[model samples]
Target chain A: MTRRQKRPFVVFGFETTHDALAAEAVLKAADLRVVPIPAPPVLGALCGIAMRIPPESAGRARDLLAAADLDPVTRAEIEDF
Target chain B: MTPEDLERAAGDSAVGGVSAYFDHAATSWPKPTGVVDAVVRALTVGGGSPGRAAHRLGLEASREIYAARTACAAFLGARRSKDIIFTRGCTESCNLMLKGLLRAGDRVVVSSMEHNSVARPLAVLARLGVEVVRVAAHENGTMDPASIEAALSAPTRAVVCQHVSNVTGTIQPIAEITRIAHNAGAVVLVDGAQAAGHLDVDLSQLGVDAYAVSGHKGMLGPQGIGLLYLNPELEVDGLLEGGTGGGSETVEMPSSRPDRYEPGTPNTPGILGLGAAVAFLGGEGAAQRDQEQLLTQHLHEGILDIGGYRVSGPAPGSPRGPVVSVVPDSGTPPELAAWLDREHGIACRAGLHCAPWAHETMGTRDTGTCRFGLGYGLTETHVDMLLDALRVYRS
Candidate 1:
């Protein structure tokens, strides 16, 4: 039997909500799918928000951001339980 | 006070809280009446944006902002108002200083008693080749100025220390530390989150290179306001670059001091509130400080009477501020904190208080102590309530 493939996703952390929102706008304008999510509580409960994107496009997304001279405070892989 | 009466008092109190607020180390409460009035007046009359226009409203807001800068400078003993750069809060101010000053491969010395606001950022800098050296604090949460002096090496760029330990309310010898750091060609950035409103901070005389302060805590202003004092001689970088009020025609951000540090639309309302808070403190701040010290002393003494309870930090009658950390023999810090809130209407902070190094120093890292933080608006009755609550919990 063939197994179904799992969809890959990456999470982006920001230092401020404004930065996260700015990243979201930049990603959407570049025609990439992005979703703003609440910063995970497990990440030390700091302020600000985060974003999730498809893992396959994550590298491209990061490059796009770099080209725009915007840096993500942190990036992490999202695991499904 | 009864729960109903306490709730009513909170509403009428200048801080507009609904219960006892022992979290002044986090942020102060019962702000001076002028704080509320100033915020309201700014929102009503100071309609235009500050530093953006030459109209009456703009000028009014600018005046208010300038007044706040002056008050903060004078309060900190800063010689020039231009040295003060207003930001969101202490966290932002710390980040501004850290990211602005330190490059890769630089060495920074910090105290074991620093808040995570300083610790975490420096840790990140560590990943980028910056050396973060931690100077240890005593069991009482006091850092030895001599230890800091010893930590200094030729490559040491700056030393970051807090003016007071928020967890234990132990005041650091900032004057001596500043002197040592400067002698070694290193600048000092003091985290004044706990000191600005609680004690006299004369930055000019102290001669520290930079001071990061929280407006909401001791300054009795709204949250989202902080100040960073950079000495006139220091050449620092800017963390955020965007639209400053002026110099829009230039392709690159301006290199001027305050404008270079401050970007985006300023928090004009918060600045106005900060001005009023400073003004109100100037009149009655000293008396309030004295009362808080007495209440803290009473609470500290009373806690000593309880069996199986250990008080952290310097002993009572020592030179300390209005903060106390008590560890109970029977239960965890959170348990006692919850019990106090449930049974006695006492509100206290539990856990490491964002200062793990402090807990590690005191050997209380296993279970952080229950912190009793007092501020200018607290009273003897509050102390009695806290003591009675702890006593009942002990039994």
Candidate 2:
């Protein structure tokens, strides 16, 4: 039930929505609080969905994803809504 | 062509045989009208290689394929569609997973009721130095998860098991086995060839590293297309490498999901057909499974009443799929199958059913067993006809 934060937050975009959804499942399973949100127009997301993570948890989220062997192509911070 | 036209054409075909089909386990018959329509549309209209370009047709094909992937992912309880990779069929999917995941000298545990798809690959792997241990199922063809735990005497790399036995219709306790395997630091792979679309399969809840399914079996799809769902975190080498349409600049295969494993041109029409079939199943799957279970339970009860004919696997009222295997005390399986077809015009599958080990476990390897696989189209009338034919042979 986490929503996209209006403040600066890191978003991870994958090649496809499926990948993003998959990563979302794993990150949540690992107890990493993240939400799947639409890519900001600035991010040029390849897919429709992207995982939004709090800036503080970005590193841990990436590590958890890497452990599971999923690599996100775009890991950028959304400065605004 | 329209479904009505296709139906008329099928009716017009000169081919004549048994009036009722009871070989759903081999492949579902009389696919949904939408399946044929989608396939036809894919063939006649949606012409282009998906992921090849941004051209109109190419994009359309890509969209269709992706939509199918999404549908399958949702249906199978996968977190995302990208986790599902398309293959030729379940056999190829099994081979890809086994060959790509297991290395020589790795220890893997499997159930004794596995079809040749799993058994053959394990056999080949055994020669390459992989130690394969099979946990025997009960006489009813159900594997006890405790047996899997016991078989893990040695540290294991993986545990391969079927969600449902194709030959026995016994549903395996996958969640318990998956937990046991995970606790042992082993990955779990479930062969859902006969379970998906027929049973309630929630991959996320089941917690398996991989789940393999066939489009032709219970999914109500056409043959020559299968799906292999790999946990995005799991690393598996591509079975084949070629043009994936993307990453054309580099000879190295695109190190990404689907494209990572799916190399070369895909079965566009088949995938679309499967998508249509999946959609159809989504609407009718529950009702179909209930009807099939009721029919199978009835068949099991009738087999018991036939008094001398031995029913394979779990007894009536047990957790079972739509498959039912029967062994007669006097006649051979093939002989009985032939008699049913010639004398009673009832269609069914007979013999080892590609699981010689399962038959051997059931003590029917020498004589094989007649398998009656009920499908969504089969009704109580068909069951009564089958029961009547079976009763005639009882004397």
Candidate 3:
């Protein structure tokens, strides 16, 4: 909920809220840490929920999502100041 | 005597407060075990704009809704949660299906025992140039697939039918009806208000294009929420459109499966309560159905033991929903219901029961019938309580 962070994060955006929730379930089950956040304006996904993950876990999360067939609509790197 | 005195007299014990509630057809009482708790929890703990914020509360609310959608889909025998659309109630679900599918000059086939939910909207669609065909139900209150097939002789746009008659409790042969309609290349939509919680409805195997259900009645959930299972193949557009928390920048509503149908802020609390209701169904559904049928049979047999009462619809042993509507030979329907409520502490629905056409079909249009709709938590003791009270009518 803090406005700023010390480290950059990887965000996965979805076209639908349900889809985003599905991805969250998959990543959480794989023992990866992720936070569900409002999709940033830069993603241009309209109104959607996106999952924020540590940059280190992005590869593992992507693998889990691919196997689960939860294709994220947009993937972006949110740089932290 | 005061109404409180009647309550004590009917309780049958020192703890005399429970009246025999026979109005499950209108809405199920004592909403299972978890419905109220879930609703309260949603209001108390589950807060924030779901899918519209990055906060933990917002994410949790969205998760609960998504979980509910999955559970509801499974309960209704649907394959994908994306296909399930939540509406205000069954009436709204019916309105959406009718408005979204039919066009001018298209024909829709319906039954004689339909509730106003279907008949009323079809009447408006009829005025708009849709050819409405009525399939006559047999006097026993069951629909004959042959009659439905006959109505489908001409090319029809849709066949709208009820899975169970709300007034008569006669379960229709929906699978057969759907097959008949599909053979004629017509879409099938069912009024599942009385059937969803009362019977085993497997939508995947049933193969109907759309089915609408009430959460308050058989599902034992909140009153404002209901469900519609739309076949993924059906291409009806959203009946009403607004913010769906998806694709907001688009000039139109989101093209997502259910979001296309659901607009504006979702009913998170009601939807969560409905979720808890269906989850209860997963374990207790068969037991609930069995208990309801047993009590219904007891009431039916007891009414016949008294000389002046006539039970309508299917025969006593016929497999039907858990509803019993009877006409008393000695008194009017309202009079019997009032007497039961005032003295015996039993609650019953009397008169036309909101289906005038169904009453006409049964030849009880004028006198109407005293209806006792059974459900969970009712036992043989309640049936005995009612039967004992009816013995006074012996002449």
Candidate 4:
């Protein structure tokens, strides 16, 4: 049995809310363009609030958040809400 | 709380929807949206045990814990985030600092308004050859710095004082006390349990050697998480020693800032919630504290207007924290509190509030006192409801 592929939208799940907020602030400042959505429930607990970015801006958003030392996003991704 | 929220929270009819929570001293309720979500996230998505290993989950958990430390450090105005150590709660933090720092034949100065958290530990130490001197508190629950200075006559090793009185909401002048203690070459350990989110506390400015706070009280975080700010210059032995993610190679506990203190697995979810709560409180604490002050004054004036009632703690306009203790002439505090809960759905504490020393100082040791600790999101409606309840009870 083969598993289905995740959607094109990249969601960054944070370990804590402050980390998500920090990422949100940096992404907005850098004009990377991301929207916050409830976690898709696939990932484990404590990262329920995640930042969703378009596939095009995922790289830039990741860069901005990384620069702030807020690498809260996990390796997981989801397609939609 | 909204009607929908109340309906959801009142799932159990026996509990009777708590219309208002005036027990911020015990633990704050209706935490920020981020706090609840943070806890949920940790349980569901972030399941790593922090400081245990370098695995993915462990690393993520460690990041969350470190973020909490940084938040607490910024909240307390510490020089660096590394100085903050996480504990079970303010009570444990107090025990760690007092038990680890004090030795036999050491003389310690404590305020009469201290909670049992500080008083009991000192009491046990007293039997073990530790000299404990208590500076009496004024009727209004304020500790006179002059009395503390006079008591400092004998050489003391340390001074333990609460930044705010949990029973009476009395705000002590800690900066002055810290200065006096430091002048006599004594280290100061401030119990900031009731003061952290209620007042502006800057460790560097206060110049205290150690400060401890409960994250769930004024900080609007989940319980089971406490913060301890130890000035790096001060050397206090660790109360507990076990597995600290680092320094496993050495048979002895590693001499480090936090690793030396934090042993065993920590409450990662609680710490994450605290980090989120502190972040939510970022830069807006002064405004929130000011609002609570206004509410406190409003409650004080309202209670006074309800004839035959006497309110304790600092007067209406005086500099104070958000807690208020009331003594009605007609009924006992527990009776009034029960009526408030059963009849009016109001929640409050009616007892010594774990600060028997404070009640003793206030001369209400026998009857105890009904304490209303106001916190975030408490509006005039709740205050009015409480006032109306008190008036009805009197009638």
**Model 4 CA lDDT for position B4:** 54
Candidate achieving higher DockQ, 1 or 4: 4
Clashing pairs in 2: A68-B233
> Can you give the TM-score per candidate against the true fold?
0.79, 0.83, 0.92, 0.81
Which candidate wins on TM-score? Answer: 3
List model 2 lDDT by residue over B108-133, tens digit each.
99998999999999999999999999
Q: What order do candidates take by lDDT, descending?
A: 3, 2, 4, 1
Q: Could you give the fnat of all candidates in order? A: 0.00, 0.02, 0.75, 0.00
Which 10 consecutive residues of model 1 chain B have the lowest summed lDDT? B10-19
TM-score of chain B of each: 0.94, 0.96, 0.94, 0.96
Candidate 4 local lDDT, residue B152 = 90
Ranking by DockQ: 3, 2, 4, 1
Summarize candidate 4's per-residue lDDT along B1-395 as a digit string, tens digits.
Answer: 34355334433335557777788878887777788999999998998877554455765876687778877898879976768888989999999889989988999999999999899989989999999998899988998989888999999999899999998888999899989899998999999999998888888899999999999999889999988888888888888888765434456875756777887888989999999989878855456778898999999989888877778888888878899898889989999889888888888999999898898899999999999999876777778888888889989
Per-residue alpha-carbon lDDT of model 1 for B1-395, expressed as tens digits?
A: 33344345544555333346677877776566688888888889786676555445655566577678878778778876778899999998898889889989899999999889899889888998899999899889889988998898556999999998888889999989988998898999989898888888888778888899999987889888999999999878888888754445455765755677787778988988998888877886667777878888888888887767888999889978778888898999999988876676566789998888888888999999898888856767677767777788888
Interface RMSD of each: 14.9, 6.8, 1.6, 11.3
Q: Is the docking of candidate 2 incorrect, acceptable, medium or high quality?
A: incorrect
> Which segments of model 4 are wrong by more than 4 Å?
A1-81, B1-14, B283-286
- Give the range of the ten consecutive residues with the poorest summed lDDT in model 4 chain B: B5-14
